[model samples]
Target: MRGNIIVRIEHDCQDLPPERRSDLVTRRLRFLSDAEILDLASRRERQYPGRNLHPVSITLPADVLERLQRLQGSRWSVSALIDRILTDSGKA
Candidate 1:
């Protein structure tokens, strides 16, 4: 039961001064235990594989960039979108 609902995090807070270290460590641990963190981590692991892909550079109009950044929220990167377009267009 504890395994599902509780998360244990081990950190070395030794460098932090004794007066504030425990509070800092507690906050950090609470952040780790958050549902949002777990969900994001799990989603990221499933989405990306553990290999480096070659990088390609592309330029975008400022308006285009702004629009895409707005539409896709935080999931869109200009480079990724350019690569996706190039691939779909049989140019990659």
Candidate 2:
């Protein structure tokens, strides 16, 4: 689990008030120790094989890079945002 794990919390907590979302995430995260999380994640990988990601380097003009960084915002990684763009355009 070297990369990101997008855990979409779509269970009973989905209907909770927006104000309670942070508390829910905090409580759920606190319930697992680092080692336990790693163990469970390893087990999951064994159970369901998925695509592996590798790093790629790309150079962009300063203005384009700045715009991409701004569009990335706080919720998404640059890689994720690029993936989304490609996927939406049927290129990924």
RMSD of each: 19.2, 15.5
Off by over 4 Å in 1: 1-50, 71-79
TM-score per prediction, in order, is 0.36, 0.35
In candidate 2, which residue pairs get closer than 3 Å at backbone N, Cα or C atoms, i.e. clash? none
lDDT of 2 by residue, 39-79 (tens): 33331123434545444333333433444434333444545
**lDDT, candidate 1, 1-92, per-residue tens:** 01111111122223434334323323333444334323332312225455345433223334333333442344433334333333333323
Per-residue error for 3 in candidate 2, Å, reads 23
Query: Can you tell me which runs of candidate 2 are displaced by over 4 Å?
Result: 1-51, 71-74
Q: lDDT of each model, Cα atoms only?
A: 0.33, 0.36
Number of colliding residue pairs in each model: 0, 0
